[model samples]
Target: MNCYECVQQGRSEVAVAVCYVCGAAVCVDHVRAESKLLRGPASPGKVIRDWPARQLTCPVCRAAEESP
Candidate 1:
């Protein structure tokens, strides 16, 4: 089977569910998600950044990260 997101690579034997936000076709050994609060400097105003945890992401997802 092919990955629903990538539609290019064959699915792994233990493919994991994809993340709705990033559309990453993660495998059982690569799937991971978590919430984090990032605190920035106080000079420009303290900023709290909530983001998803990293995992063994696919090439497409990696590309997205690089672009952003």
Candidate 2:
């Protein structure tokens, strides 16, 4: 897909990441890196485990939105 921001800027650029919140495709220069928590299944008596994970988001969505 094409970069949304680049389209606005009157240029056609290849997308490197898609926004997790809005699903807008964006180029590397328009993407922001964010971390998400991943949960692992555990027994009821045991504590749930979580690990940091990565998600790519567009600049606009990254500013005012969250992934579900």
Index of the highest-TM-score prediction: 2
Model 2 C-alpha lDDT versus the unseen true structure: 0.90
* Tens digit of per-residue lDDT, candidate 1, span 1-68: 33444444444344576755566555554544444554544555556555555545555565666694
Clashes of each: 0, 0
Model 2, residue 64: displacement in angstroms? 1.1
Please write out the lDDT profile of model 2 over residues 1-68, one tens digit for every residue.
89999999999999998888899999989999978899999998999999999988888877677545
Clashing pairs in 2: none
Candidate 2 Cα misplacement greater than 4 A, ranges: 65-68
Measured against the true structure, the TM-scores of the candidates, in listed sequence, are: 0.33, 0.79
- Candidate 2 has what TM-score? 0.79
- Evaluated with lDDT, which candidate comes out highest? 2
Model 2 poorest ten-residue lDDT run = 59-68
lDDT of 2 at 53: 99
